[model samples]
Target: MTIQQRKSYLIQVGAFLSQFKSSGIEKRLDLACNDPFFDQMLEQIDMAVHYNGWFTRENVLFSLEEWDKALSEENLEKWLKSYNFQEESKTVGLVMAGNVPLVGFHDFISVLLSGHKVLVKLSSNDKKLLPILANYLVSINPEFSDKIEFTDGRMNNFDAIIATGSNNTARYFEYYFRNKPSIIRKNRNSVAILTGNETQEELKLLAEDIFRYFGLGCRNVSKLYVPQDYNFDSFFNAVLPWAHLMDHAKYANNYDYNKAVYLMSEFKLLDNGFLILKEDPGFGSPIATLFYERYTNKDALLETLQAERENLQCVVSQDLMESEVSYGATQHPKLWEYADNVDTLTFLQNL
Candidate 1:
């Protein structure tokens, strides 16, 4: 397919999504919490992992305009070649993350837009959503369906691979898959740095960056690197809108346990509604409670962060202007900002 064809395909996908905006994706998500199949899946996920809230269709709608802006033809071409998938016709295997609904779908989009076939290994936790989406897209343009597959089999025949897994699994991937070209995204923790320079409304927007998807995404702010003189009240006042998250029993339990840990272990505790502010040490995976930080001079702190960038995926604060973090915009990501630093399409072209 040509670039124009790709553009039309994206429009069809957007049209499908637009239908839900009126139908109200948020309501559907809330109902999914009570939906028998979804509830059953949630139980299995929550058994070993902490349960967090859902991302509604409205949540999906919330960021679409900017996301669409991020996907212009020139930008797609640049982002495509940035991952080196131009003029290629090879099978690309993607093992995606289920951290949030459709969290890493960009990798698959890149594969198709660049004229390649894809073998997707869906996370069991997020199986239903993607298949339904794939069916919708195929209905809009059936020929494209031949290029995509949801598979459970080993992808040994694929010319290249892109996998997102925990940090531990990254080492195994490197040892086994290193013989060929690959982009492997390991566990990463994203942080938010506040200068205490914003209004309540602005900070509330940033709270969406940390709390959306119940703080389960790699982009979620798990640690906040802030200035020493910052006012805690402004932060709390900003995040009050989301306090209702605590009403969900699954997330509340995490809040309760972590609150006790702060009290018993003598960790500095900062709690305003559902958001936790702690001088707690650090964590890669965000909990319902517990955000970390230590004071530092802004210049020195940025240099320190520069040294730590290899382990960081994307920072969500406005302070790091030279870096990707933008202020009052933690939850709103522009298009083509590849999460996990592994641009799958480019990895394939190099292969």
Candidate 2:
């Protein structure tokens, strides 16, 4: 199919996904292919939670909502307006990540929108949702069936590849795909730069950045760069709204286990029953824990962050830097916000 046809199919998929939200599932009469696909989609959501404890109903719906917002006609037009797609279709192999629901969807859509076929190897943690949507796309237009393929075992017979994994797995991908064009993504964590002058409202929004998806997404703020001698009382109080996260047994178990490990090691910690803050210079923190470093100078902190940019997925702040994402907006990225600062559509087009 043509690029426009592919985008039309995706817009329909987004419409289908928009029905399943955190508030409630509202199946509209105007949606196409609602007969068995709608009920099947709900079944897949339940199965997602059953297979992976991390894929809660709220988190999965949040992901769906974000995608729905992204696939609007305006957003897609703005995103793909500049790309020139006059190339022959090639099969692009995609190795997806399962850290959060539909984590690798951007690459999946990019390959299709760039007028290429996609061979996908689904992450075991997120195997169900995408295939159902792919089926839905086929139901909308049979052309998609020729364009999408999912493999459980080794992925081959593709022109190029894009793989997302941990830093170690990235090295393996690079070596394995050395002869072909590829984008090998490594582990990256998002961080927030907190000035002492931030308003309580802003800090509360920052809480969303930290706690959303139970802090599992690469865009989730796992570390904080705070002013020296910054008091924790205000920050902790601002984030109180998310204390209900303790209700999740998996998160609570992680909180207890991390707290025990910290206490046994005599590490200094600030605890609020649900989340823990530890003074660490690291970017990636354990679940239920946030690592923080104190910065004495703003200019020096910027330099340090610039030096570590490659290791960061996002730098969230309030007008602190030119490219910084806003306080609560990291997880709600725009359609053009390519992960790892690598343009997937450009990569696919070049291939």
Candidate 3:
């Protein structure tokens, strides 16, 4: 199929997804598929949450909505205009991460849109949603059936590789795909820089950056760089909307365990019933906890962040850095905001 045809099919899929929202699903749009297929998708969304405790309904719908916005014809055309897809097609291997729902869908879309086939190795924790969406894509156009494949075992017979995993697993991928053109990603976390002048609305939005997906996504802010004399009262009050997250058993368990450990160690902590704020210099924090460090000056903080750029996915700030992601937008990256700042489409087209 031509690139326009492929993009048209995905636009149809996006139309179907836009009908569903976090509040409820509504059949408002005139979808191309039958009712049974749409019904099955709704069932799969619920089944995905059941299969993975971290995949809450709200989070899954948030992911779907983000894609629905991204798959517009204008967005697709604009994003792909710079790339040349006339080169010979090859099979691109994908090692997907399951930290959040549909975390690897961008790479899947990139490989196919670049006029190449895709062989996906889905993370076991996120095995349900993508295949169902892939089926929906195939239903939109039978030609797509030849473009997608899924494997549970070791992946092979591909031209190049795109892998996302922890630092340790990345090392294995590097050794295994040493001779191939590859983009092997390691663990990276996002952090927010607070200037102590942010309004309550901005602070509330920043809470969304921290608590969304239960702080599981690399884009989720796990740490904060605050002014030396920053107060916690405003920040804690702004996060009150998400206090209900403590109702989740897994989250509550993590909270209790982490709090207990901190208490035993006699560490200074600021707790507001649900989330814990600790003075830590680390980038990656445990679930139900947010690590923070005080910065005396902006220059030193910028230098430190620049030095740690490789270990960071993105920086969340107002005007601190040139590439700062807005307070609430870290999780809702656009189609071209490739993970690890590695352009998947360029890689695939070159290969």
Candidate 4:
């Protein structure tokens, strides 16, 4: 299919997703053979929660809505406008991350949109959702069936690669795909920089950055850099919306386990009955716990963050650092907001 045809088919898929939400599902499309697909996809969404405890209906719908917003005609056209795709197509191997729902979707979309065939290695934790969506896309345009392939074992027969994994797994990827052009992403965590003057509203938004996706996404704020002597009363209060998360059996178990470890280790922790905030300089924090460090000087903190840029996926703040994501917007990345700041479209075009 041509680029315009690909874009149009994606837009139709987005429209189908827009019809469903956490509140209810609706039949808003008049396409041929859509009823069973819609009903089954909704069933898959419900089944996804059982497959992975973190994949709640609310979180799944949030991911769907975000993609629905992203796959618009305008967004797709604008994002692809800068790339030239006249070169021969290649098979692009993708090793996806399953930390969050449909986490590797952008790369999937990127490979297909660049006119290359994609061979995807799905994360076991996120097995169901993307395949269902891929089925929808194939239904929209049968050509995609030829362009996309899912593999359960080792991935091969690709000209280039895009792999996301932990720091340890990335080493294996680098050695295995050493001869090929590749984008291998390692562990990276997001942080929030908080000044003493942040309003309650902004702090509440920041809470979303921390609690969304049960803090599994790379964009989820895992650490906080706050002014020395900063009071956390308002910060604790702002996170009330996510208090319901503590009710989840898995999250509650994590909270209990982490809190017990902290107490037994004699580490100081601030708790709000649901979430734990501990002072730590590390980038990655455990689930249900947020690490924070006190910063005495803003300039020094900026320098430190800049020096540790490789370990960071995003910085959530209000102009605290250059190009920092606004509070509460970490998860709502734009079409061009490439993961690890690596331009996937350009990578595919070059391949």
TM-score of 2: 0.98
The Cα local distance difference test for each model comes to 0.65, 0.90, 0.90, 0.90
How would you encode candidate 1's per-residue C-alpha lDDT over 239-337 as one tens digit per residue? 777887887676788888878877798866777757667775565644776466766677787787778887786776654557767644555554455
Worst lDDT run of 10 residues, candidate 1, spans 25-34
**Model 4: per-residue Cα lDDT over 101-218, one tens digit each:** 9999999988888899999999999998888888888887787888889999988789999999999999999999999999999999999999989998999899989999999999
lDDT of 2 by residue, 241-292 (tens): 9999899999999999999999999999999889999999899999999999
lDDT of 3 by residue, 1-351 (tens): 777777888888788888767878888537776476678778877877788999988899888888889999989988988987763568899999999999999999888888889999999999988987898888878888998999999898999999999999999999999999999999999999999999999999999999999999999999999999999899998999999999999999999999999999999999998999999989999999999999998999999999999999989999877999998999888888989899888888778
How well does candidate 1 score on lDDT at residue 233? 81
Q: Which 10 successive residues of model 4 have the least lDDT summed?
A: 24-33
Candidate 2 collision pairs: none
Between candidates 1 and 4, the one scoring higher on TM-score is 4
Off by over 4 Å in 4: none
